[model samples]
Target: MTETQRPLLEVQGLCKQFPGVRALHQVNFDVIPGEVLALVGENGAGKSTLMKILAGVQPPDEGQILIDGQPVSLANVNQAMDQGIALIHQELNLAGNLSVAANIYLGREPKRFGLIDSRAIRSASAQHLQAVGLQVSPDTLVGDLSIGRQQMVEIAKALSIDTRILIMDEPTSSLSQGEVERLFDVVRSLRDRGVSIIYISHRLAEIEELADRVAVLRDGENAGLLEKDQITHDAMVSRMVGRDVSRFYQRTSTPPTIDSDATPILKVTDLVVPDHPQHKVSFEIHAGEIVGMAGLVGAGRTELLRCLFGVTPPVDGDIQIDGTYTPIHHPIDAIKAGLGLVPEDRKEQGLVIDFAVEPNVSLASLKAHAWLGIWIDRQREQVEAAEGIKDLRIKTPSADQIVRYLSGGNQQKVVLSKWLVMNPKLLLLDEPTRGIDIGAKEEIYRLMESLAESGMAILFVSSEMEEVISLSDRVLVMHEGHLTGQVSGGDINEASIMNLATGIQAVS
Candidate 1:
């Protein structure tokens, strides 16, 4: 794309090493003016390391960065900004307590007569906000806005610096479908205006839809590159992992028959979630079966899971685990009733990032391993940690290693390990593979299949249609807090799920 146009940014022989790990080795890539270049790789493929080096957050051990054919030293973040490069990290860096205009020009506020220029801030902030197509008042508090709107504000703030090169890291990981479409429109507008965009995401579908050129990295080295026309799903997957991942969903056993007379492991009747008390939902998930819950964003899928797990108690319902009625008034009650929940935002709900893996693994089952149900048992905790790590193939230096330092996928495994301690009859996974890379996704998919085969009933909520289709034996569709329909066998296709999700087809 615009190959004749001189490269706006070029990375040459970039090398970085961190103690025992060689993060990048002679890595090279370039971006032309006004194009979306997708940088993709698995979780530990040196993507974050390279991005940090480019943004000047960390200095490269050896390398050269060039802008318009001239080498430049991005020795510090301020220098990177001066050279027109800005990075929007996955975890947003906005001061939520401040106003929109205040956040846009947080430290670099315009001044009038040596005083903070409130009027100038509002007037100029409006233009940048419009550039990102974010329709919000400059006086609006950042905390009051939704996650999608806040993301737009971050882009607007970057534009305030007149950024010519923008790097977005997993920008849509937390966004809804409508929000994703809006963000794509903004990216297109930025590219059309001669601003080079470096888009990084694990979602290959997004790369296929948006990228003009895709650069794949593997194990800290350049794997391959694909031009616009060559960016198919198989091509991207092969390049990233150096293999053709045709069978992404690893299901060895046959799918369970949904209509079988076998006893259901978990059943809910007249289940009324606190968020949507008007609707009463009913569903059943059998032992050794994986049930997928499909619905549009904000359709109360998460709410229902929360209700089932007792994060938010239901207004009224009967939840039976293995044919026993369990009225869960709290999360502990749910756990006692043989239930475990892996919430969507793992960092917040699942694991304590600052804590070690061993502690998190035994957190839920502490009493079970405790002596006289009083003091904790350290030896038992270690055994549990070892088994979990070995069983899940978790990659970590030691059980004492802080979980925050682990890759997204490994961190997720730690979360799952925490729940495996309980040996729940039913596991509720909300957006199970939300932000992890593809390679990790395969591991998790295999784990789901394995767990189901081992007789654990799984009820997972997912926004990815491919994931639902691949893993689910039975599909339950929801619309506006209502259980609208169920599909099994060949009926578990995208059209049926979407129709049921949108309430176009409801069960009689």
Candidate 2:
């Protein structure tokens, strides 16, 4: 790409304001043909808001968007698509009940006449899927596919459009390492075909790998733009956060205490579920310890967490809390027993989007705000919610701001705050850092450490091998619902963990 080449999309003086705060402050950005422009920002930095404006999910309160050097108005999603702009959001927009082909060709299905053309749609969808390296049958229902496959279907849908500029928001957040590589390949092919890509992601490595130019946004404004040669992880971090974060991952080691040898806080024995009956699972997590669960997708990692959290009942198992065995038949049982689960899917299960930030943060411990046997104490709730927001560095105009308006990272913080209010003896975190920016991820890591130091037992589950290895005191590798192996001390690493996860017997 040369400096003389015209940009496919140009945004100037973009601004968006809500009731109390300005979300975007005269933001300016542009994307050129056949180039990948990485948009880097912390949560609440207005990246999503800007993208929504470009995609016509919302119109900008101020500024102009030029397509091919001509001012244009994107009134709605349909108009945006007609103008060759497509956006794949972090939360998938696909209907799980529909087939892959149907989802890809959803509203714009090809028709021979004025009637439906299922055959043509299926054939076109198959071609698009192949272009994106997705091998799933076009007729397969999207709900049955894994998160990674569903993401591929989304990319395939975008590819099927005559997209001049595509916005991908955290596309690889849940994808496995192999799947990420495949996605990168697809992106490269799209770039080669002269499609401009506006890539928004938290994964710095992915940005470095796929972006031709990196643009940093801070406090709703364009901080700076660095060419590929000048872009380093530290540089991008400093730009996005306005401070040097050299020790982001460095945690002060707290020595194991006398209570470490005491009774286990959470004990799962012979836990079995209908979806995964291959293994009789057993694990014990003590207070003041962070136990990590590592595995590939479909290895039953999530199922194990779900069962323990009472989202799915264990067919046969004994759960012991504080030396007393108990049966958990529902989530309420787990909650009453001092167990807090921060679910993997924030939008679907963890958050009530329509609710305000304060309400969402105080959800798990709302009973604490009861003034009497009948009345709810709004003052106490607001106080606790304010503390949570301040403690977690959650950016919002006010505690009364709707959670749906916050960015992905801020939303995750609200979820964490909801659980933290309970002050549980045990915490179950499944992909806690999913879709959050690097700065927010660092904050979450520090928060985890602080919680552990406070004698809270955390069972952390993540697909990222590095996160698992860096944060876990003991790594439990799972394979097809079975405990494949356990890595402690020096035994935990990418290669060693991968060996156990892939059934290559290195533990023996």
Candidate 3:
């Protein structure tokens, strides 16, 4: 950056260390005023650490943070806000039961005659909401709004506090396509008004579309920075991974050979998910095939998986494992029928983050290895953990390392290890590589390929069009709870899948 173009926010020699993990080390970056600075990184790359430090959620072990060329003491979140800085986390932090106006002015309401000025809050909230293009009434309950509208409320809340530097962390991860476009419009408008934004997202397409410049972090350090002209997908991925992952997802497993009368590994015959019971879905996966399910955020893909895994009961359906009708009303029944699921929110549903890596790996299989069906089998757990650590290349100092302390990629590996140990006939993966870095995603893809080659049936869901197209031998497109199209080989392009996903096409 030119000396005359002074940065609005600057970090130098920043460092953060956790037990068995160095989150950030000597990280340095600057954000110019009125510019949207995109931060890209792999899991455990220290992006979160740096963001936390900047927002004063945590103090760095060593470093200097400057605002407008002067060092500042941001010992707390309030102090950070006092300096016109605000953070919007990936999962929004908003009270659902409160009204929009009340939520916006929470903890700092305007007062008149020693009473809260509700009218003033509503008027100010309306202006802020308009600024972010939210048309909801100020008195609308926050809980009643859609996820996209709630996000706008978050931005409005930041504005209510007179925020100048807004940090958005994965803001679009939950939004629909239309919502994302509207958000981009608001971001550009904010930048035009001289509001500096630090944008964080794993969606490189978004970075390319919105960022004036891109800064990449790898292993808790600055990997590289790219100007607008240099902000291609390949450039961002290469920097984030410290290597070129141009061939990002390649399916190496050949198609499974099956006769017409062969019994498929998994068959869903007129399966009815409770979320979309009216739309009966039917599909089947052969023993060695990898099937990809692609759809929009509310397309019922996740619900289908939940039903198949017995997490959510289906309304009416027949699930056949090896051509035998199996009723999976509970997770144990699904497990006994040789099925496993790695949920999208691996942190909450898949792994016990506070527990050690070894325990997480053997969690699902512990019952099978237990002695007398009641006693814990310590020896089997230890052996399984050690093998998983080595086989999955989980980067941990030892088996006892807490899953929470591991990088996003390693945490995901632990979750996968849990299912792998069960040796299930059919595996279900929901957004398998959602929060991981490109390198880790590639590793997971390799594992999937290897598993498929070994005759394991795999069904996976992905929001990323690239991942769905490149990894799956067959793509099943879902729209509004309906399995609209099944594309394979020569017909599985983005346009075809999107046509079905958007309800413009159907299998019939």
lDDT of 3: 0.91
Best by TM-score: 3
Clashes of each: 0, 0, 0
- Model 1 stretches with alpha carbons more than 4 Å out: 1-4, 18-20, 247-250, 257-263
Segments of candidate 3 deviating more than 4 angstroms: 1-4
Q: Between candidates 1 and 3, name the one with more favorable TM-score.
A: 3
- Cα error of candidate 1 at position 243, Å: 1.1
TM-score of 3: 0.96
> Per-residue lDDT of 351-434 in model 3, one digit per residue for the tens?
988999888998999889899998989989999999998888899989999998887889989998899899889999999998
Per-candidate Cα RMSD to the true structure, in Å, reads 2.5, 2.2, 1.7
lDDT tens digits, residue span 107-131, model 2: 8878878888999999999999998
Task: Report every candidate's CA lDDT.
Answer: 0.90, 0.87, 0.91
Instruction: Give the best candidate by lDDT.
Output: 3
Looking at model 2, residue 197 earns an lDDT score of 90
Q: Candidate 1 residues 1-508, lDDT tens each?
A: 4456889999999998764557799999999999999999987788888998889899998889999889999999999999999999998999999999999999998898999999999999999999988889999999999899999999999999989999999999878889999999999999999999999999888999999999999988999989999998899898888888874575677886555676688889999998888999998889888999999877899999999888999899898888888898799999888889999989989999999989989989998779999999999999999999999988887898888767788889998999998899999999999888888998999899989988899999998889999899989999999888999888889988999989987555
Q: Kindly indicate the candidate among 1 and 3 with the higher lDDT.
A: 3
Candidate 2 — which residues are off by over 4 angstroms? Answer: 1-4, 255-261, 367-374, 505-508
Better of 2 and 3 by TM-score: 3
